[model samples]
Target: MSTPSRFKKDKEIIAEYESQVKEIRAQLVEQQKCLEQQTEMRVQLLQDLQDFFRKKSEIEMEYSRNLEKLAERFMAKTRSTKDHQQYKKDQNLLSPVNCWYLLLNQVRRESKDHATLSEIYLNNVIMRFMQISEDSTRMFKKSKEISFQLHEDLMKVLNELYTVMKTYHMYHAESISAESKLKEAEKQEEKQIGRSGDPVFHIRLEERHQRRSSVKKIEKMKEKRQAKYSENKLKSIKARNEYLLTLEATNASVFKYYIHDLSDLIDCCDLGYHASLNRALRTYLSAEYNLETSRHEGLDIIENAVDSLEPRSDKQRFMEMYPTAFCPPMKFEFQSHMGDEVCQVTAQQTVQAELMLRYQQLQSRLATLKIENEEVKKTTEATLQTIQDMVTIEDYDVSECFQHSRSTESVKSTVSETYLSKPSIAKRRANQQETEQFYFMKFREYLEGSNLITKLQAKHDLLQRTLGEGHRAEYMTTRPPNLPPKPQKHRKPRPRSQCSAKLFNGDLESFIKDSGQVIPLIVESCIRFINLYGLQHQGIFRVSGSQVEVNDIKNSFERGENPLADDQSNHDINSVAGVLKLYFRGLENPVFPKERFNDLISCIRIDNLYERALHIRKLLLTLPRSVLIVMRYLFAFLNHLSQYSDENMMDPYNLAICFGPTLMPVPDIQDQVSCQAHVNEIIKTIIIHHEAIFPDVKELDGPVYEKCMAGDDYCDSPYSEHGTLEEVDQDASTEPHTSEDV
Candidate 1:
């Protein structure tokens, strides 16, 4: 049991120590393998990244160069071309071309920024990754070397312990064998003495001597064997002691390798590699972030430049640059050739008669062409109808042929039907052909007639212009007769006859007399109501009130009852305004009478502000006394209303547009469309220059003056703030009057 235990213990100790060492070596090998693999992966990845960045840098640089070249090419082209240069100079920075330049520049800048980003990746981020990979690989190699050295050392210690253990076991077995031999020798010697002493065993002297010798030899051998056994035992003890010490040292070394050395090597390998990789990744991310931020900033600048473009300003700039090109052409004047007639009557009559004759001839030609064109048009339409009928019959024949083909009729029958249809089809086609020819001829006739008519119309217009010029020339040469003033017979006012007789369409003078106020009752009511409430109403006069409400209010005014007198809330402000506008529009005679419309409109054409105002004033004073008083009163109210233009959006211009035609309608004989704008301008001028145009009613010796002298409400005239009555009278007396109305 002891021997077996000894052998088993020695084998177990060696086997355990070898197994631990092998496991440690295997773990170190695995770590080294892992570190190598990671290093290889990192290197490959970094190489790939560097290659990508290098290519990206190249692309970005090339792109930037291309953008720069493109911009330069266009810019050079523009600079070299005369028209482009002129346009650039004219429009300056506000032009679309300038905006395009800015856009191109921004694009170039963006390209450059991308190039910079690429450079950053190539020079900084990629390089950093390369450094990290290189550093990690180097670290991996160093760590692997150290691990191998540690494992080797541990293996050496384990091998030495194994050798020592084997030697000890061998020595122990030898000692046991030597000890067994010594015991056997002693036992054999004892047995021989017993045999010799036995009676049955006779021994001679020689035999006795040999036996003694044998015994002696046996003892001596025993002694010798005992000595060998002692020596072997001592050797085995020494070997065992050596083996234990080696085993202890080997275990301690292996434990230290696993707990300290291996851990340190693995940590060193992984920490540096991971840290490098982390830094490289962070740098890459930061580079991308910075590139995006720069790109966004560039895009913002480009967008703002694009948004700032204005084509209208460009056109205006061009106009400013080339003023002479946009200037009006020189006006044409009549020129007399050499040897022109000196006789006034005959020469003028001859020119007039020739123009009249030419005009009449062009007119007659135009009439004949128009009649011919109409006849041709009718003939063409009739011919087109005949062609349509022919086409319809052809379509029916074609469909009938198609039906005959689809049916199971015999080929002979089909052919016969086709033959039978062919003739009629030909006849129809011939008819269609003739009808088409007739239609085309009529169309040609119509076109010719239209062209002739256009030519004759142009001739007629030219002749008319010539005749107009001749007449104008004659009128310019002749002096206008100073006709005596026609007597204006005053008519007696008629009393109101019926309730339906509206006050709005009545004579202004009759209404003024009936109201007994310089400003009519309706006008005063509307103005007062608007000034009180509707002053802040948006689009005061531009927005119309309900027709029903306006009519009702108008009837109330005509019934001699003030619909807007009290409880103003019952009447819509717009309705009251409508009533006022309706009254002015329905006037038998406008405030600026029709007779004076031309004179009033002409005043607006005067260039000088002071003279235009004086002209307007003179013309306004020529109005009948009742009309002039109402005009002054109405204009004063309008001027006051315009003061609140900000709230009502009814400045003098807007008010003028609303009341221009109402107060001074264009005459029937005049081109109302052409003169409407002039009428509005005159009204705007009167409203704006009311202080300068119309005198204060208090200064006037008329119905308004009597009312003002009585200290009436109308006495607070719009122009009363200008000067005293004496000053106004002096200024008025100095002014010239064309009629006794003033």
Candidate 2:
């Protein structure tokens, strides 16, 4: 009851409580150690089992390989005694290979009347089934040795796995108990500490006057300590729960590895039995119950193991236990579970995917826009260049518009000065006169021999008559009227072939189809000519004409032979005629205009041949794109073909002879001389030196023809505006627009 006695008693009581707390802590520590040991053992057992199964699979593979080799040797020794091919064919009869299981199905139809068969036949049947028996027996014996060892190792691993799992659960439960007892001991310590009165609280029961306040303080202190103790207990409980969860997860993992390894071992056993068991064929054929039962038990064990390892909880219970641990619902599922945060998340994902797709489409469109912008820029540059070239050409004086400009004039003068200066001009003039006399003599003789003089005169008169009624009488005076023209010899033109050249006129298409080999051959020649000289020209020049012509020729030849067999030599001539028709049809301006037909014919009777040639050149140059392209390649084609005329196919003269009437469309000639003269003059001038007819860079550049000819408003617009060279005399009458005016 005294102060020292009470103090001593309190100390002793505190010591006893402390000892109990220490013992509880010691028990918890021991349980923790046991749990750790069990975890380590379980891990070791799973690892060992994995190694065992892997080794068993390897051994089974080796055993099967040995069996295969033995079967192969037995099959070789027991091959049928027949011809080599027949023996080779029958050798697979009982080949003891694993994949040959399907082949064994042939045995089902074997004769069951063995009782009626001779002794030799029955013996052969016995030999066929048991042919490889000894080798199989030896292989099976070796497999049995391996199987026994594998089975023992597998049993040992399973036993260890079971024992370790059992020990782990036991220690896990003990650890939970120890943790609870430790919590209780800590509570008891807190109660004792409250009774003993700590320095921090400073409450004493011995102060009688202040006893109520002291009691209240003591009660407060006790309550505070109890609350603090309860919190610490909660922390301990959480720690214990976490530890148990970790252990349970470890157990689940160990169980999975065990079942997987065990399943592999079972598979290996089944393979060995099928491949290397004693009497395996008999066992398989008979559907042996004992082996099947064993396999069924092993599969059942696997199923049970999987079920036991699966963590068990109803849907509601799982949600209560770990509400946030599950995977989020799919986007569609969120629709049914509407008004949840998941719907918002799903919407965000869908929006992100759509945004990504849109972003890719935008990138592709931007790339295409860049390409289109580049093409537009290039085309604009080309158009500007074409306009500038046109302005330069149009700057020439109207009187000499067809003539070369001052720059080209200076070049011609310089060349003339170099070769024929003032001093030598007289001497050169004398030599040119003599050469002219000789040329005229040769021309007169050639004209007399060919008998075309009268025909030329008649053709001239015919051209005059066809010139339109008002002009026909005015132009008829110069013609020689006495000559009678020969009767025309013409082939009935074939119907046009259905060709892909849709732009061609009917006359052009028909001529090309009739010409056959000649058209393709000329197309090849034209292609070669353009590739050499017309490289800078645009439009169809960019086309691979030579290749196209060759392909067309090859295709046409494949379909049938040329139709112009009776007139093979004339085929080339007809082809030239067809080409001319194509040139006329393609022109935006007709070569022989329907409106100005008489005016163009009047130019042929002009006094000076050079002036007349210039007038005709101007007329031809009035034709837009198609004429220029045709003139360039046609000149080259005729020039190229003229050299090969010795073969009797076609020359420039023959082409001119054939095409003049076709191109001009003059009336029937009364005088043969006039007809021949008109025909020869055109053929010699236009087809040979075509560049002389269309000499301007403005003519060659594409825009003038494309813009002026193809436009719908060509008639109302001037030549400068619409690209058609209309009313040259009217233009010359006005003050011509200089390049600056343009």
Candidate 3:
């Protein structure tokens, strides 16, 4: 009963449960009704996203607007500063931080108004931009240099294209003309048609006429095609011409012209004034920065220019215009002829009076000197005779005493100090025989050329006598019982005399070399000039131009330097040796010992001078790199010389340094200026030559051309290079090719 009844009941229950679930679900779904909460929550989330995006966009827009405003204001500042008074003073760009504090204190005491500050936006931008501006300008310097080269290349490319296109058009025209003639040679003909490897049919008379007509139509069609080609080519040519014009305009506008007027209050002034003003303005701006100051002036300038500018119609023409209305012309008046004449007359009178008095005094002094010199010669001869007689008697006595003195401690050797021992077998074998010839050649050079020498005898005579056999006796005869012995000369023999001498002498000749085996006369002159200028101990003075005076050198040496330290003596030795070699082309002879100079002066050999110079040239040509190293010596020498009473400094008047395959030997005795002009002319020619031929090393072309650009400042000229010419220029009169102004 349970199983049957449960089955029927379960079916009834399942059907009723299904119906109830559907009614429950339908009632539950229909009961939900409030939309406001869901709508409001979704709307809030969407509003938050929208508001975030809007704020971000507004911030970005504001930032961009501010940046543009800053750029415009900066441009305006640059433009205004172009004319300002403080544009170029260049001390500290920014004042010390404390400076503004001091300024504020003073301002506060003077008045109640507080220091004005720029707006936050403008001040902040300016501070950032100043750092950026300096960096940008420096970085752009390289770009600007590169731009110049680019512009030059562009011009070349454009020119080449124009030429190639012209040639192509001409060739095309000729080819078309030839083709037209060929068209006439091509014609149509009728022939018998027969079957051969194919089936063939002959046309009727009317058909043959049609074939001929077809050929005529083809000829006409070819002509039409040719005409069409010509029209298309014409269009291309027009387009190309328009393109060229557009290119020219674009090139013109690529650069900007910044016009800067002189400050309003300043009258006609020099470039120096402008540069000073620019530096000063930069300094003030760097110093006067304030966070809160208003940039109204800068804004106003930008706004005015923006409002005033009109859209350009002729861009090419506008860019071509230069910044012309800047500095004004200064007025000057020429001195009258009579006024100039009077000035010259006065100068002449003063000069003549001085010269006349000098001449008279000189004549009187010459006469007196002649008498004194004669007496001195006589006295010298008499003293020599007495010395010879005394030496003979002293030798006799010494010889007799030598037997006794050999056992004692007082043997005098006066003869050894003055005489050199004859060459012995040991001495001869010590060095190569070739060194003797070299030595003889060098010795002959000394005989020919006059160089200064420091006499060892003059330096050590007192030491020698006091320490020799006569010293104790002279002391015994003169000493007052208990006087202490004085300090004696201490000798320091060193590596300098041997090692430095070898190192320096090895490259001595080579440093003076020029482009080739044969040094030019101008180079020779320069070498001589350097020699005379550097060797102040020699009886030579660098007067002006390349001329020197012997007497001045004597006076300077006679007024010798203070007691020299050992290092100083070596320096003097090296200077003398190096300097002399520059002139005579032999180091040893130039820095000869005083004993050596004495031997030369006592003899004569003029022919040896030329030989030494030639030999030196050969020596130098053998080594190249050492030449530059030694030339630095010339720079050092120029630095050391003192100025003369009649001079500003002692150095070369001018020089043209050559770096390329040096051009040399313009025939004739043309002076330094003419030589300079000739070299400059050659450089210009090389620069203008096809770059395809020379390549980029042509900057080597610079020195020769720019030689004339070198000024007195670079050379340490001894006098004004103005209207005044050297008195030594007179020597050039005999030299026919030399200029009066030399």
Worst 10 residues of 1 by lDDT: 330-339
Please, what is the whole-model Cα lDDT of each candidate in the order they appear? 0.59, 0.36, 0.30
Candidate 3 TM-score, true structure as reference: 0.19
Better TM-score candidate (2, 3): 2
Give the lowest summed-lDDT range of ten residues in model 2: 330-339
lDDT of 3 by residue, 1-742 (tens): 2446644654564455346434433322221111122223334543453444345435544654454455445444643552322434542334543364334333332121111112111222233223223322332333233333433433443344344334433443444444454454343211221112233266577866666676666567667656655654444333333233322322222211111111100111111122222222232232222211376466456444433322121111222332122212111111111111211111133233443343344334444554554555465445434422321221111111112222212223122111123464235324323342343333323311211111111112222232445443543454332222221111112222222222112223332232121222223323334334333432222122111222222122222221222222222323333223333332332222223322222222223323322332333333333332233223223323322212432222211122111222232233332244444322222221112112122322111111112223324444223221122223222322211111
Ranking by lDDT: 1, 2, 3
TM-score of candidate 2 to 2 decimals: 0.20
**lDDT per residue (tens digit) for residues 482-536 in model 1:** 2112112122133344222235566877656654555666777777776666766
Q: Which scores better on TM-score, 1 or 3?
A: 1
- Badly placed stretches (over 4 Å) of model 1 are 1-32, 66-105, 192-216, 267-271, 294-742
Question: Which of candidates 1 and 2 reaches a greater TM-score?
Answer: 1
